[model samples]
Target: MKKTVLVFGLLILALLLMFQFSKYAVISGDLKVELIVASIAIVFFFIGVYINKKTLQKPNTPIEEISHKRIKELDISNREYEVLQKIAEGLSNKEIAQSLFLSESTIKTHVSNLLVKLDAKRRTQAVKKAKSFQIL
Candidate 1:
C-alpha cells in the first residue's frame, strides 16, 4: 500500500515538472485543451479502478459452503462422478455424451441427477460445487 502511494506521488511530481517546463515554452491554446481532456480521462480511469477494486471481493456464501459439505457426504456413483469431471473440464452435455459414447439424453439425465445431488441450478454450478467438496 505504501509502495503504491509512493509511486503515485512520484508520478504526480513528474507531471508537475512537466507542467512547469511547459510554462517556459510558448504553449498553444489547443495544447491546453488537450491536456485538460487527458487529465480528465486519467482521473476517471483511476476512479473507475478504485471503485472496481472495492467491489471485486469474492463472496463466501454460507449456502455455498453447506452445499459443498452436503455434496461431499454424498456417495456419487463412478459414472456420475465421471460426468462431473467432464463438466469441470467445461464440456457440454452433448460433448460429454460424445466423449463417453452415450446418448445426449442420457448425458442430460446424468447431469440432472448431478445437479439434484449437488443442489445446484446448473451444470457449471454443480461442477464448481463438486470441486469445492473435493469430490471431482
Candidate 2:
C-alpha cells in the first residue's frame, strides 16, 4: 500500500515539474522568475522534511512495558516458549515438529497451548505477543 502511494506521489511530482519547466522553452519570455521560484520551493521542501524527522526522534521503550504487562497477562509454559521461537522463525507446526522430533499431533497440541496461554486468537498473534514480551 505504501509503495503504491509513493509511486503515485512521484508521478504527480514529475508531471508538475514538466508543466512548470516546459512553459519556459515555449513562452519565449523571462524564465529567471520561474527558475527562482522552483529552486526556493525545492529547498524549503527539503528543509521541512529534515525538521519533521528531528521532531519525531524521541526515544522510548515500549517493549519493556509490554513485558511487564504480559507477565501479568500471559500464562506460558516451557513448551510454549519453544513453540513461539519456532513461530518467530516462520515455521509451520509440522516443520517445528520435524525439528523437535515430536509428532504432528503433539506439535498441534503445543501450538494450541501457546494460543491459550498467551491469550491469542491465532498463532500469528501469539508470536507477535511473544516477541513483544521478549519471550521469543
Candidate 3:
C-alpha cells in the first residue's frame, strides 16, 4: 500500500538523519575538552574587553537646560519651532510635511521662515543655530 511505503521511507530517512548526527556528535575526548576551553577563553576575553571599555569611558554630563529667554529673543514661532525640530532630526521638507500632515509647500514656507529667523542660509545651518541656542 502507499501508506506502508510512506512509513518505511520516513523510517529510513529518520535513521539516516540519526546516523549523520552521530558522526558529528562523536568528537574525540581531547577535541571536546579543547573546544569547551576555547569557548570559555573567548567568553572571558569579551568580559575583560567590556570591563576595560567601561573603565575608560567618561561619565556622561547632564544635558543643558532649554534657554527660554534666548528662544524668546529669537522670536521663533511655535509652528516654526516644530519645523526646526524636524530639521534638526534631518527630515526633508516633504518628509516633515507628511509627518505633520501638512502640504509640502506649507512645510517649505515653514522651513524658509525658520532659516530667516535662525539667520542661516541652509537647513543644516538652521539646525546648528537652534542646537547652539538649546531651542532644539
* Best prediction by lDDT: 3
Residue-by-residue lDDT tens digits, candidate 2, 1-136: 7965875587578667766775764476656566756865786587568657866998885544335445446766666667777888999988999998888899898888888887799888987877767665
Using Cα atoms with residue i matched to residue i, what is each candidate's TM-score against the true structure? 0.48, 0.46, 0.62
Write candidate 1's Cα lDDT for 1-136 as tens digits. Answer: 8977876787678677656655644265445656665765686588669757866977887443334445446856678878888998999888999999999999888888888888999887887777777665
Give lDDT per model, in order.
0.75, 0.74, 0.78
* Candidate 2 clashing pairs, residues 3+ apart or interchain: none
How high is the lDDT of residue 22 in model 3? Answer: 45
TM-score of 1: 0.48
Model 2: residues >4 Å from true position, as ranges?
Answer: 1-73
Task: Give the best candidate by TM-score.
Answer: 3
Arranged by TM-score with the best first, the candidates are 3, 1, 2
Q: Cα lDDT for residue 51, model 2?
A: 57
lDDT of 3 by residue, 1-136 (tens): 7965875586568556645544555463333655655655675576568657866999999888888888789888778888888888889888999999999999999898888888999899888888888887
Better of 1 and 3 by lDDT: 3
Better of 1 and 3 by TM-score: 3
